[model samples]
Target: MAAKDDLGRVGEQRAAAYLSDRGYDVLDRNWRCPAGEVDIVASRAGLLCVVEVKTRTSLRFGHPFEALDDRKVRRLWHLAHAWIDAHPGRAVHSRVRLEAIGIIGPDPRSGMLEHLVDLR
Candidate 1:
């Protein structure tokens, strides 16, 4: 696998741990469907959250979340809907939240993770 892929995986694991520590119940990691891929799917305070994780060695270019442009947001929305459909029991009256997580450091395992929840 490419180094970026490893960073992404590690970033995701960090995101899960971060969320878990914050009282969110994680339902899925790397959730994918025809629409797109959701890095993390979790529930908190009766709301469903779709997280997009971005990991980089540094912010020299820009913040990791900056990569998730409008197109990505739309795709994430579709992916969230697909996830909802897959789990009927968890969809009713639930709200969709778009979150962005950024990890930056020399290595994925030791990177600093920053989570920005409810982007949309």
Candidate 2:
């Protein structure tokens, strides 16, 4: 894998650990459907969260979250719905929402992680 891909993988793993430590039950990771992909799927307080993770070595251009535009958010939503359809038992009667994680550091595992509940 590319260095960039490795960073992202570590960032996603860090994001998952962050959620798990905070009492959220992680249902999936790197979930994909015909529509697209979701970085993380977790639940807490009867709510299902679809998380988009962006990792970068530095913020030379912008924050990691800046990578996601309106188009990407729309695609994430589409992917979330597709995930729900594919996992009926898991997402049954649940309220789904979009979220994001941004990581910036030389080592993503030790990077600064930020969580945004809004993608719009």
Candidate 3:
């Protein structure tokens, strides 16, 4: 995989671990539809969470969370609905939310991860 792809995968993994440690039941990762992709699907406090993870090597360009623009947020909203439709058995009946997890730096152990919940 490309270096960027590796960074994203590791970042997502870290995000999942972080969420799991916080009592979030992670249901999926890289869930995709024609609309777009959701990096993590989790449930916590009776809410279905659609997570978008942004990973970066540094702030040279910008903070990773800064990448989530309005357009991407809209797409993620659609993708969250699509995920619910596709996984009827999972029964995600509670409220749905858009969340963002930003991972900065290369090392998963040392990187900064910021979880911004309820983006929408």
Model 1: residues with Cα > 4 Å off, grouped in runs = none
Candidate RMSDs in Å, in order, are: 1.4, 1.1, 1.1
Q: Which is superior by lDDT, 1 or 2?
A: 2
Q: How would you order the candidates by lDDT, starting with the best?
A: 2, 3, 1
Cα lDDT listed for each candidate? 0.84, 0.88, 0.88
lDDT for each residue of candidate 3 in 1-120, tens digit (9 for 90 to 100)? 898888889989999999999999999999878777789999999899999999888899998878888988888888988999999989455799999998888685569899998795
Model 1 global lDDT (CA atoms, 0 to 1): 0.84
Model 1 lDDT tens row, 1-120: 998787778778888898999998889888777766788888888788888888899989988988988988888888988998898986664477888888898786788778887785
Which lDDT value does model 2 have at 95? 83
1 or 3, greater by TM-score: 3
Provide the lowest-lDDT 10-residue window in model 3: 101-110
lDDT of candidate model 3 versus the reference: 0.88
